[model samples]
Target: MDYDVIIAGGGPVGLMLAHELGLHGVSVAVLERLTEVDETIKAGAINVPTAEALDRRGLTPALKAAEERNRAEYLKFVRERFGESAGPPPPPVKFAGHFAGIWLLGDRVDENDPDLTARGSASLVSGVRQQDIEVLLEERVTALGGKILRGVEVTGIESHADGVTVRAGEHAYRCGWLVGCDGGRSLVRREAGFDFPGTPPEITGHQAIVEMEGHEQLSPGWNRTGTGVYVHGPIPGRILTVEYDGPPVDRDTPITAEELQASLRNVSGADVKVTGVRSATRFTDNARQATTYRLGRVLLAGDAAHVHSPFGGQGLNLGIGDAVNLGWKLAAVAQGRAGEALLDTYTAERHPIGAWVLDWTRAQVLLMRPEPRALAMRGIVSDLIDTVTGTTYFVKRISGVWQRYDLPGDHSLVGTIVPGLEFADGSRPADHLHDGRGVLFDLGAAPETGGRVRRVTAACPDRPDLGGLLVRPDGVVAWATDASGGESPERALDTWFPPDRR
Candidate 1:
């Protein structure tokens, strides 16, 4: 085999998986179609789960730097808009997120909530671009000794009992495993014959960074109008318009300035003229998910496994979640650390999340419609979103704090990302995950470390009742117990990190 794993896409998802595999000393290579990273206007921010994943990998410094840059840009915009009279730029409204253009204010969130209090640095959303995330992951992948073959579009795949053979143009590479992180129109998903099933597109949305005239005529921030929805100017020259006029005829066609102008006018009724478009993309609320994440040796992740509307900025975060969840499991299987059945859990755990995202986006689509019923529903939702309870509920869902896998054991922490527990030594659980190994946080006489699991004996002042925690490499809590007697870690270890399973 040319590599332990060959990833078909060098987007953030593929690069993240490559980093994970390389961390486990698995030989991996990423095959990307683009020669250079495109500056397309994509996801503008990442959610809590993605931020925590990166934090575990010791990428918080870079994330903070990116956040500062984004903050500076937002501050500049605020000053320009408010004429500098507004003191300190109002600290750039830390919003939880939005639903159907309805903003979820961060100030309204219940900070005492367990999910919110548990997340240390990842408690807030990070204002970083998807392009920035890809670049960061690409750098991390390379630094971890992973290869990235640019301009190598995977054309075909042949999955055998032993391994899979990937074909790209004139070359073929063999690997123990192949993951399709390729976008919505994934060639690997098609060649692997995974059944993709879901609803069709109903609305067409345009997001762009353009030089335009009459831009001021549009409302600032999210606006749900009688026609559709349009967002203007948090970032200079940035605009987004949504119209329930069906999907684009040809999504492959380039988005011209004229087309953008028409969309802006149709949605905002601003008569805006897009004089020059810097970057643009067309999207729709066409939601779909593969029946399974893996088909034999060929697996899928990111948009290859699922595709949904970019509303609420869920697509990028969902892809990152898929990559993180699948990365360690695939690496363990590829390196012969675990049985192949472990791969099945990837689909079992992620499929439900993907389905929920599709439903979430579909709900937003329903609310965003300009019809009377949708408008009435939107008003009720808006009212609910204004309250503290409503804000916290939506924030928890949007931030991914509400996500918990259905694993064995009745413990509350089981199947949830272990809270960012800071020990007596000032080191957190995330600090131990940098090496991509499972951790046994031995708070009160936990079991000894297995070959693949690292044991960290530390005193947590806050949660003294927490006896110990068995954390998977991906940060999910497999088993946890308080000071009193509960389920032992042996079963969880045997299931997730069995010693020398071949």
Candidate 2:
């Protein structure tokens, strides 16, 4: 076999998966037809959940630096709630302010508060450009001994029981599995016979990276007009503009300078001269997702599995998530340390979420439109809606923290997902993944009975309730019980990760 795993696209998602697999010492290779260049594509937008995923993987320092302004892209998250002296409000109200629980709080009201920086998930999310993120990922993957072959395209793919075969540059390589992170037009997905079904992006949007000298009217936190949405002030001077209506854009073709200039003129109402064209891409809000994330030995992730509107800036964020979700599972399966059943969870957990992304982005295509009718309706809703809780709930859901596979019914407290915690490992005490070992977190200091479960003292004061949690390598809690270890934790553990040879 040429490699254990071959990622067809070298975009953010592909690079992230490669990096994740590299962490587990997995033999992986990434094949890309496009020669990576220094261009700012995805205007830095790291949502809360994505930042958390990076943090859990111990990549917080690198990702945090990439978050340029360190703040969310919304006003305030509003919900339908009745105050002590008022009646029930409508859906969440979004304003140009920093308020959690609501989704649409993009602009910075104040930059002094650390929490307002949107630095972390469960707290806030900062923005990061796609180009910078890709650069970081490429470095990490290469550092981890993973092979990245740029300008190499896959002309053909053939699958067999033993392994899958990929033909790239007159060479036939075999691998236990083939993954398609190849973007919307995935050659691997096509070769694997996985169908990509959904709506194509309808609205035109463009993003470019530039070191802002200064902008006069971009203040008052986040600024918006009927032509487009201009988000500003996470960083003192940096700004991001979303143009819904502009010149026709073709993804397969190189974006043109004229198209960008025209879009800026029509949307921003001013011809803003950019210092440097770091990177530019023209794509509409498309709502398409792969029917199945997995087909036999082939699996799909990121843009390969799902493609949607970037209004939520979830395209890159969600793609990174797919990598984290599947990386450990792939590593375990390849090392024979996991059962085949473990592989099925990848699709089971991610496919539904992918579908949800398409649905939500499709909605944004309408919700965020700058049309007079849409604007008037939003304004009315904003006024009628006094409570911001509903909107906050919706935004939080879209933020991806609401995505939980191991639900309450799926397992007990120990079987749920445990937030990253600090623990001591005997002689050498340190903080690592709450997962990785797939051991159920026995926070109760479950006595040293001869068993497969590893009990550790939960040093995190915030999650005292999760002290006796049993965690899986994929970071899902398998079981949660009292300090007295009896049958429930053991049963959940047996079902999750069983010890045979030991």
Candidate 3:
């Protein structure tokens, strides 16, 4: 085999999976159609879990820099549009996320809430662009000795019992496994025959950066017009408009300035004339998911596995989450460190998460419609989201701070992002999790941890009752304990990382 795993698409998700596999010393290849990364910001929000995932790998510095730049840009945009205020420019819009254009306020989140406190929710949401995320992941992948063959368009895929063959251009390469990360209309998914079933779109949405003479006519902030919703500002000339028109026949057709202007007028009911267009794209609420994330030796991740509306800014985050969940599992199987059955858990754990995201977007699409019932429902949701409890719930959901898998464990902490436990040395559990290995965080000096699972001593300041935790490479709690009185932690370790397999 030319590589242990071959990843199609060199976008953020593909690069992230490559980085994870590379960290485990797995031979991997990434094939991307684009010669270089696109600088335009596609999805602009990085949720909490994604930030933590990057932080564990020492990539938080880059993410922070991008966050700062994004914040500064937003501030500048606001000041330019509204003029500098005397009272310190209104604290950067505390409520950064929304559902169906209805804003969810961060200020409404009760810091003292018991559940929120236990989750160890940090200042995790950011407005960094997808391009920045790709750059950071690409850098890490290359540094870790992974090959990313850009400008190589994947043409065909053939899977055999022993391995899979990927055909790109004039070359055909063999790998033990193949992964599709190549976006919604994925070639690998189609050719490999993965059944993607979901709802078709009822509306078309357009986001563009354009230069217009009459841009001032369209007000900033969310506007629920008689036709559809149009949100402007947070940046100059940045327009996001939704039309109730049916899904377009050709999503791949390049968006022209005139077409965008017409759609803008139709949705906004304003004759905003476009002078020049910078960049634009079209999207829909057409949600879909592969029946199974894997088919024999071929697998799927990111957009290749599922597709949903960008309503909650979940597309990029969901894709990265897939990479995080699949990377270590796939690497373990490829390296013979674990059985093929381990790969089955990836689908079992992630399919529900993907389904939830698809449904989440579907709900938002329903709320955005002009129907009287939807409008009434939108009003009710708007009120609920303005309160402390409701805002916290949405924030937790959108930020992915509440993500939990259904692992076999009795502890409430199991299958959640391990609480950010701090140590006496001022280092946290995340500090030791960088190597992409499962951790037996022995808070009570547990004796069973040694070879396969790395052991660490940390103070569980928040939950002193918990003696230890078995953390997966993705920073998820596989098993956790309230005390070392039992052998459950050790048993959990054996179940997940059997020494016999190694």
lDDT of each: 0.88, 0.62, 0.84
TM-score of each: 0.97, 0.78, 0.96
Number of clashing residue pairs, candidate 3 = 0
Better-scoring candidate (TM-score), 2 or 3: 3
- How would you order the candidates by TM-score, starting with the best? 1, 3, 2
CA displacement after TM-score superposition, residue 414 of candidate 2 (Å):
5.9
Q: Which prediction has the highest TM-score against the true structure?
A: 1
- For candidate 3, the per-residue lDDT at 361 reads 93
Better by lDDT, candidate 3 or 2: 3
TM-score of 2: 0.78
Error in Å for residue 279 of model 2: 2.1
The top-ranked prediction according to lDDT is 1
Query: Candidate 2, residues 1-502: lDDT per residue as tens digits?
Result: 8788988888888898888788878899999888874454454566655666655655666766655333322211111111134332342222222221113543312233322232333234355667767887798889899999999898888889877999997988888888888887778888788877786555666665443332342332334567776554333333455666543544667655555555555665764554445556666766777777888888999987887766666688788878878987788777676676877878877887777777766665565677787766666545433344534444455545456664343324433245544444421111245234555445664444246655555444544544366665555556555443444555665555556422
Candidate 1 structure quality by residue, lDDT tens digits, 27-128: 999999999898998988988889989989988888888988987777666665566774443343333668888888767888788777878765564899
